[model samples]
Target chain A: MLRFANPTLFLKLVRWLLPLAGGAGAVLLAWGLYLVFAVSPEDYQQGATVRIMYIHVPAAWLALSCYSLMALSSIGSLVWKHPLADVSAKALAPIGAAFTFLCLVTGALWGKPMWGTWWVWDARLTSVLVLFLVYCGIMALWTAFDDPARAARPVAILTLFGFINVPIVKFSVDWWNTLHQPASVFRMGGPSIDPSMLTPLFVMASGATALMLALHLAGMRTEIMRRRVRTLSQQLARQDGGS
Target chain B: MMDTPHAGYILASYLLAGVIVAGLVLLAVLDDRAQRKALARLEAQGLRRRSSGQTGEQ
Candidate 1:
């Protein structure tokens, strides 16, 4: 793992892993969607609306997972000062924001038909909104600084501060009385979902995870190249100034 | 499910997710190409990265 701290070595690894992850993501998503529509049974109450869960649940899970990843990378940036750590964290912001946005939108879509409203100020819902806002804030912070190196420490600090929301977002469903259902797939008593539905949900989650990984790798590669460009341009400026 | 009463909502959810995912992929790919091009242009201009040898072939 430490071997990956070198950006060049990391890029070499990404060259191979990116395509593999993207391919696996595509295949798994295709298979998962097939099962979602044709194989999984509808909820006795929600009917076809339950089909939305196939995507919603996975998006929700990924949103939380993405933040957790950012927090971990932020730690690396601050503690170990891993060179690729800030790059990894920076790259993940927009992707994590996208997933969080998807989760909210899908949840709203699912809500309208089932709850008869587009949104509510419930604990689970509101905390996720806060999570989305944090993602946006981190992205903005990355852009606020002209120098990537200068931005790294502050961004990592903000990320760690924002991580308080992760546990809040996860446990909100249980900690408070909310419309969102509590822990269907992950719980002390094991999953309450039928195997048929559970299978597709897990498959979709895996696919989304793979796709996120590919995107993050691509983002990191671009960031590394970007830093190099900045350095070269600075060097050119210095040379012109010297001459 | 397309014919179901809530099909529109279901469709919208999936469609929106698709669009967002596609947008992210496009951003990653385009940003990558742009940076690579900028690096090539800089190198062509006789500017070499200070750590060029250590970084290996990108």
Candidate 2:
């Protein structure tokens, strides 16, 4: 992993990995969508509305996972001073924010049909909202400084601080009385859902994970190039000043 | 797939997710391309990046 701290090595790795990740994501998502819309039987209670689970659950899961990745990268940046760690953290912020936004929107869509309201101020929903706001704040903090290098420490510290929200978001329903349902798929007894439903959920989740991986590589590639551009321009400025 | 009692909500959720995910992918691709292009342009201007191991032909 530390060997990948070299930008050239990282770039070479991503060049091939991006296409592989993208292709796998496409195939899995296609298969997952087919299973979701065509094969999985409707819930007797929720009917067709339950199909929304395919998108909502994966979005929510990925949202949390992305934040976890960012926090880990933050630690890497602060402790190891890993070259690419800050780039990874910076790159993940918007992707995580986007996923968090999707989770909220899809949850609202699911909530309206099943719970008779678009939203409720319950522990689960409220904590996820807080997580989303933290995502936004983190992103804002990334650009809050002119020098990206100077921005790194604050961003890392804030990310570490903000990580408290992740567990809160995950266990809120279980810990408190809420309109949201308790964990069905990841509880102590294991997933209580039918195999048919569980299969598509995993497939869709794999696809989403692959997609995030592809985007993450692309984002890091962009950052590396952007850093090069900044360096080159700064060198040119210094040369001009000296001349 | 669109004839159910709450099909609209389900469809909307999927559609929104699709749009957001696609938009993110598109943005990442475009940003990568733009940066590469800028770097190439800088190289073309005889400005070689130090330590990138590129021999820039002026």
Q: How close is candidate 1 to the true structure, as a TM-score?
A: 0.98
DockQ of each: 0.83, 0.59
Best by lDDT: 1
Lowest lDDT sum, 10 consecutive residues, model 1 chain B, at B49-58
Interface RMSD of 2: 3.3
Clashing pairs for model 2 are none
Candidate 1 structure quality by residue, lDDT tens digits, A1-243: 778778888888998999999999999999999998888888888887888898888888888888889999999999998889999999999999999999999999999888999999999999999999999999999999999999999999999999999999989999999998898888998999989889999999999999999999999999999999999999989889999
Q: Indicate the residue-level lDDT of A194 in model 1.
A: 88
Best by DockQ: 1
TM-scores for candidates 1 onward, in order = 0.98, 0.97
